[model samples]
Target: MAAYAVSIAKEDNMSTSDITKMLEAHADRLPTESGTTSFTLTDLGDNRYRITGSRATSKHFSRILGMNSPTLSSSAEIAKGGTPAPCVLATNTSPSNGRGIEMNNNARMTISGCSVQSNATGSSSVHLTQAFITVTDGSGPGKLCHGGGVYQANGNAVSATKELCATVTDPLAASLPTPTPTGTTYGNPGTDYSWYGSKTFQPGIYSSGFVANNGRTHYLEAGTYYITGGNFEAQSGAKIIANGPITIIVMNGGTIRITDYSASANSFQAPQTGPYAGILMWRVNNGSCPNPITFAGGAGFTYDGVLYFPGCLLDVSNNAHISTRSEFTYVLADRIMMVGGSRMTIDVDNPYGLAANLGGGGSGGSFALVK
Candidate 1:
């Protein structure tokens, strides 16, 4: 009897479709017996379900069940079910070339179950510098086979052997302009200003810490915001909407933290040009311990600016979507980490182009390495 049951189970495993049909037919009457094996199916609600049974039956359950739609194939393909990643990670093909993600210095990137799609059609997905890249748990270039792979400056961009790898030069080496702090002392050092709650402000030097929280929306006019001391935070559904050009300068041990994972997460965007051209969040070297600058927002969050903080750690994640809806985005930080389903875009066909103000164009500074 035992031999007979094992034989029957092996035969049943050969055809997943048949097993699925049997399961669906008996959906209302789960925990049914199938050839001496009892299986239990529980509806998890919201079109999702969970099934448990003998090892042989549950093996390859998801693959055997199969998805109605295609999954993430490469970093260059748009996400089929979830939010599309902003960077391009596809390989290069004919006529149309694919853009790639670029990371620099000792920075690291890790991606899992995410699709890094190209900004445009027929472009590569990733362009990485001398950084470590890691991909695991079903992460890769999406859809298109060509122009959806890893292009590294030193060697193969991807850490996984199964990834499509190629050789490419670091395009961002020249574009990131080093900020030369120039100005007579504008504000006294060690001053603290806490601009909290909901309100609007004109552009000028903010001589202290700036905090916006409690579902507040702070509006800033076209100008520069100089944060002299302490940290800058926008949390708890807080938002900073820019009506015109704006720049945020974090100095004297000051940092920037944008948090709260909700759709109304703390969010803001800077301009694309002017005296602060190609620069948005600037943190000067104040001889203090480096702090992490966190950016968290919803899918509508689109930031166009250069985040220049050579003395700080950059944390960009949390279902945030920094679309390339504007001109471009450039950053120069001590270290960087991008994960948590965040999509930071670098549009390929934009009129302003990548780091245009800093004299960047055509594949330079266009890649980020995922470690």
Candidate 2:
């Protein structure tokens, strides 16, 4: 049970003139804004990179060359007397030039009994960044790659891409941002509700806890939503309507559970502008509690945002065909797992990044480093 709201901003329905003025102002800023549309991680030379986020404070990474070997293991069996649906990890942002998954440290990425495909067509090189790699009985990039070597039992493993052994300073947003709407309070902040109804959740701080287990549809408008020190859950056929680009923040030992929804009826789109741009679910807290964050998707589901939980475990299991239709997703957690018949497709072809050329156009859950 999680609930709290300091000040919330509802759909006040701005006037046409107000909308036009806002758009015009945005247009004026576009000419010189190097970090528009989404966050930018600019290599400031001298082994430094500056990350410009939307609502959160800017971050800088100096000497991020640590090491964590990433492992992506796969298992398959005959499903209902049919070939097991291919479970994959890929990036479509630039086809031959995006990372399907990434992580920082000396951890090695291992995969077996599945396939790893980038958008590159016809025997293109697979790209892995900053970590050791391992693959068995799976199809991945060729010998041309960055970081570690690829070993496939089926002879799909590429040569060693040479590890940079860099560390992701804070894969998720380092600084917690204030909510976007600083206007009014919607629900009572101190009370816990088993939220049910076809209503809307404005932007504000729900500091207690929030859960929605009833099978219902809800709309979330544009703004930042804060769920602090509690469990944020949504299950039992809950469908979300992402009315605008928004960010959902979970802080201070807050657990998250979002599952049991029809994927065909939902699509979680990240904000295209601001520090929260491209970030949908962000969990910022010290890794003290053992509670896990569970996120499962149905068939044809898509997540066009960054699921940032640098100090927590993110479980995307026990659900079938999750993240199969993703436009872009970035996962930065202390740990991540996809098992129990769960299937996912992490496409990194949108504005987010996988490989180099972070200018624009690419998508899917980028890898993160674990401690």
Candidate 3:
């Protein structure tokens, strides 16, 4: 029988239907099972092939081709001119061993639009070493996995242009979580400078000095503190330690002058706090206090913490000189509105090379400057 034929139609172009008919005819020429008809269509051209009906089993197809019976060389492969169209093997019934598809060492394969669900023990999906695999949307809804979605290892690198979505069945089981924003704030200056603690004033004109006696700590809190009219000198051994947290909120349009009075070693400590520690002036928070705060004077000031202000407006016409004794220095605020004609300088230096967490955590946060 001329099982395979090449016929020329009116049009010179050869159609795929013609090639399929030729291959089917060739397959039918082979011997059949005793009483069974000796007609079948198995191989497609271009190094690709297919199996259908009851003869689709590994044994039946392997015996006809004279090759080893494969556990799963299952799908149909279409011929595409030069190379073989990638094979797609699928199964209706679950495999006892949970093995889905296995490709030859040199087989270049790609799987798309499939799903693996309710599998036990073995991985839901597997890609071997040196295998290039890509998952893409097909005619259907796309791929899904229940047990272990897709497992690609053995030094394999996977990449996707789109986002990967997954749902976890259990909450306690190790899984990724959505992130939240928790910002840091300066301490309250009123409480920090009370008789309980010590407040360090920069080189500036203060009417009164910060009096500390008998190991007592006196510092200011976030609220306003009264000071007489005089040059509040930061003497040779003047240091400010915030007993709790301190935020210098200038209220009633009061002016505080911070100058660098140290002839040699002048240092200020600005420690990190939670949600409210820093410099705030000309700002009103009706929720807490409705008084407007104001800040003035720009002398050389050094703080070993973060400088932040959101609600208050600043006048930097007198550019303040700021420096840090330690290498770790971070300047962060809710909103920094630098007025025209003001100069501000910041210096961060730590001799031991220690980096402090300016935003509480070393990394992973947001910083914004609103007019």
All candidates: TM-score: 0.45, 0.49, 0.25
Q: Candidate 3 on 1-371: residue-level lDDT in tens?
A: 12222222211111233344444555544334322222233444432334332222245766888986443221233332211111121221233444333222222222232221222224533333433334332222222222333454444433322122232121111221211212233333332444443444332222232332333333433332223221122322333444332333332223333432222233444333433233221122212322211222334454554333222222222233344333223332211222212233322212233333322211111211111
lDDT tens digits, residues 180-248, model 2? 434444443224355556667777777666565566666778887777657777767766677877778
Indicate the worst ten consecutive residues by lDDT in candidate 3.
362-371
How well does model 2 score by local distance difference test?
0.43
For model 1, the superposed segments whose C-alpha errors exceed 4 Å read 1-197, 261-273, 287-289, 297-300, 326-328, 351-356, 360-371
Between 1 and 2, whose lDDT is larger?
Answer: 1
lDDT of 1 by residue, 1-371 (tens): 11111101210001123233444454333332222333443433321223343312222454577833222111111111222222223212221234333344444444332223222122334445565555332222322112345456754355443333232212233444443344323342212234445456665555656666666667766767777766767676656677776778777888888776343433345655565665667777565535777775553355566556654556666655554423334444444445555545443224233324342312222111111
- TM-score attained by model 2: 0.49
What is each predicted model's overall lDDT from 0 to 1?
0.44, 0.43, 0.30
Residue 201 shift from truth in candidate 3, angstroms: 11
Ranking by lDDT: 1, 2, 3
